[model samples]
Target: MTRRITVAGVSKFFYLYENHSNKLKSTLTNLARLRMRKRRKFWALQDLDFTVDQGEVLGIVGRNGSGKSTLLKILSRITVPSKGRIEMFGRVNTLLEVGTGFHPELTGRENVFLNGSILGMSRSEIKSKFDEIVTFAEVEAFLDTPIKHFSSGMFVRLAFSVAAHLEPDILIVDEVLAVGDQQFQMKCLQKMEEAMSQGRTVLFVSHDMRAIRRLCKRVLFLDQGRIVHDGPQEEVIAMYLQSFEDLAHIPFPDSESRQGSGALRFENLALIGSDGVPRDEVAAGSDTILRMRYRCLSHLQNVIFSLTISSLTGQILFRCISTVELDSPFSVSKDGVVDCRFPRLNLNVGGYLVEIEASANGVLADRVREAMRLQVVKGAYYEGALPNRQSQVLVDYSWQINPDGA
Candidate 1:
């Protein structure tokens, strides 16, 4: 057996300039005043070391800005590492972003050949796999259309199909699957599984833990550009979940990653128990409340509050909207608190995330993702033992049996 990929002390640093004028000035100044320029150094990845054996599926998991994308970009040779070295043994293809390696002016059919050529495939080879790619992408009807005219889903489908059918020895996929529809995502996963069966090496990066658990035997947990954990799948995921226990209340104003109109902003979010006590952990099948405090900068009309509960791996378990679920539309003119109470949270024992959003007149006012962290403990959901991890929810039902003769 051979090592398909080896990364030793890999680190990537990027310099951020205050403005384009400053960047030009820094370049003009050369080494004279370079140290005195208004530039900041940011490390997207630092000291990452790992290896993947031939035909092994490796999953990388982390929060946003944890350097998963930076490592993948390095692996794909899109950028050079500032510190260390990486060795890849075979031909590689990457599905990093939507429409990557595609020409907006060219038709889908033309871009397929273009991308294939960029991947080092000969004309004959691309022709041989052309029909298979189109079929897999399910874009034959729009194959002749310009890529710019295709929807995001269509673009990703065709891009993934080309990468998957090119038969590269190593496939590197980022979170691009999130852009496609669920059915197409499943198809892409099946294709990756097929590639793995053929003894092809794979490096998968995704926030979806269920997919990572299903596809990869080994996992790497990254935090702030460093490899925090590298081992079995379950253990790494458990460690990742445990890291969230300390994140009780998150202030939204401090988060620059949020996006929405400036009409309303979430100030803080917390998970509380029935006793109105802020807690990070709650017993399974127990009452839990999600308290969201927001400040309205101006008068709002027909405002609705939306909440989503998701697993740590980014699987959305359930969602509740005040307008849709409760058939209630409310307005806010000042700062206040909104509480979404769950009488008996039926989620199986695990860690989950609460996402908050505010909308008015079908337009988004504000949204904060992963606003609060919640942990579920073992409780009286069942008579004997609680349900397994495979079960998403627990339901209490009585069993009835009658004799045939009766």
Candidate 2:
């Protein structure tokens, strides 16, 4: 089989300057100082070798700054590699960013034709597909309005619709689909599936493991600008997720990113089983507790602590809020621990993330994303059987039926 895309020893290097002044200074200093410079060279991708068959759908997964976007940009030809080579055998279309390849001043209607031309489509071809694109995007009402006026969701919908309908042989998609609502995201996923069914090659990058598992047969896991694992989707995703198993409890200040007023910040986070023992693994149908230790820098009133349970892919599955769930106005005047106990955690066997948020008087005090990780194992849920991954949560219910002649 012919390889549709071949990336061999591809590496991209970028220089980091402190500021505009530093960038200018570095340029001048390099000229006079010969080898002395303050700028730092960062490798976005390094020695990445991969090939895609004529009709393969490949998924790329990594944490932030993992070179996923850098690899995609190189593949899409948006940027040149500092070293190595790439060979592509078909017309390529890319959706690497929000409103990519779009003219903000042009109306949505005009951009469709413009994008089609860029994709090597004739005017007649674009005209024939114009209606379908607009209908699929559901942006007919704003067809003539400049894209600058469109919201992020609208931009994503229209941009994805055009790229998917342009009939390119190779499509490269980034994580931009997260900008749209769930319905539109699903629509885009379905369209990608349809394109794959038609024998088109796709390179998809997403944090959504479920979507990746559903679409791609192979996966590439990148870390620190290198391909750490590249193989079957299930194996790669499992390896990628298992790497985070050690982060059972994370200190708030040591978190990579955080937001809020900082009046109150979480000190630590942990997951405990029914026996109140800190454990990363919990039974599917057993009770579990999420404990958050926090300190109040100042007196705060009407503070609510909320915890959100999300899948490994970052989809929020369930949320518990102190104000809403407990029906009590929470306040913090000193250091304490807030425990969110679930009577029965029905999540199937999988890895999940916990996010914590603290707010005071309707103002955000502190928030942490993916503060903790937990793994659910086989338990008494669904007659002691593990539910399929497709089912987000397992629910207990009873069914009743009436006889025909009751």
Task: Judging by lDDT against the true structure, name the best candidate.
Answer: 2
Assess every candidate by TM-score: 0.63, 0.63
Model 2 lDDT per residue over 1-406, tens place:
7789989999989998655364667777788878655578988888999999989999998866789888888888888999999999988888775444689999999999887777667899989999998999889999999988986567667877877786778989886554355567678778878999989899998766667888999999998899999999989988877654445334555545799888998887877665455544666776778888898877899988888889989999988888786667776799888898887788888888888999999999888987877787654454334447788688888577888957
Residue 197 displacement in candidate 2 (angstroms): 0.9
Candidate 2 stretches with Cα past 4 Å from truth are 18-26, 29-35, 146-155, 249-324, 328-406
Where does candidate 2 clash, by residue pair?
none
Model 1, runs deviating above 4 Å: 18-35, 149-152, 249-324, 327-406
Q: lDDT score of model 2?
A: 0.80
lDDT of each: 0.79, 0.80
